[model samples]
Target: MNEQIHEKLKEIKQSFRLMMNGVASHSMREKWVAYKINWGVPIPDLQKMAAEYGKDYELAIELWKEEIRECQVLATLIMPAEKMDEDLVEVWMERLRTQEMAEMLAFNLLQHLDFAPALAYKWIASDRDMYQLCGYQLLARLFARGMEPNERGINEFLDQAHTTLEGNNLPLKHAAYNCVLSFCELGDEFDVIAQKALADLNIL
Candidate 1:
């Protein structure tokens, strides 16, 4: 990395140290076992840092590689969604080790990508827990933004969600439920599918 980027990373680390809360970090670590490095900086603080740093894809990539949870969150915030693509998204998804990271990537980064809808479908169909959660979360974000999938896409998603719900994984089931809820809000056309999915999952 260049001197500028190196200095910026240093500055961010310094800021993290200054703002870090030991009690909160311990609490967060207890909740998120996947986060080995928890600085315990709040989201608002991270947002302030992101605003100061602006969008720097390169810097964001570097920050994302760090083990620190807050750094990873900042990375998503600093990354320009327009600069995101399938390959990078795949790489980042593979790095996600916690539901918190999955949700951050889904809502803060993945949801803003041009390929979000397509990618959401792909991830939701995956057998991996984190990938599926990210996919469902992304779908919910898209739904909140008033984006609706076609009939075929809807069917495919609901089918996958049903399968996930049938499984014994609580996290995946939660994601599937959230995805179904988002779909149900789209229109009456999806009501039957949603109800069927909920009923099949014993959530009705």
Candidate 2:
């Protein structure tokens, strides 16, 4: 890393240390978060920090490589969407280790990307749980924003969501459920379609 990024890393880690919560960190561990270093910094605090740091692609990439939960979350918040090309996104996806990271990236970063729809669709088709969770979460954000997918997209989404909801992964099911709910929010037509699609799963 360059001197400037190294200095910034030191500063960010120091800030994370100052805001750390043992209780939150313990809870996350109990839930199997598995981050090598988790400061237990809350999302609101991370957002404040991101605003202070502003967007710097290099800094975000370095932060993400830290293996610290707070830094990764901060990376998602402060990353420049335009600079996060497909290859970079795949690299990050390969590094994803937990559902928390998936949700954090989906909520704070991927949702804003111009190619998020295609990305979400691609991930949902993956057999990996984390990928599916991220996909569903990203789709939920898009749905909440009232974005409409074309017929093929809707079909693909419904198939993946139904498969996920029917599976045993609670996190993926919940994420898929949220997507369905937000998809319903698009309109009554979407509502009917989603309801019919996942009715057997007992979620609308």
Residue-level error in angstroms, candidate 1, position 86: 1.3
Best by TM-score: 2
Query: In model 2, where is the ten-residue run with the lowest total lDDT?
Result: 195-204
- Flag clash pairs in model 2: none
Please write out the lDDT profile of model 2 over residues 95-179, one tens digit for every residue.
8999999999999999999999999999999988888889999999999998999999999999988888888888888888888
Q: TM-score of each candidate?
A: 0.95, 0.96
Candidate 1 wrongly placed segments (more than 4 Å):
none
The deviation in Å at residue 10 for candidate 1 is 1.1
lDDT at 194, model 1: 80
Error of 2 at 117 (Å): 0.4
Shift in Å, residue 92, candidate 2 = 0.6
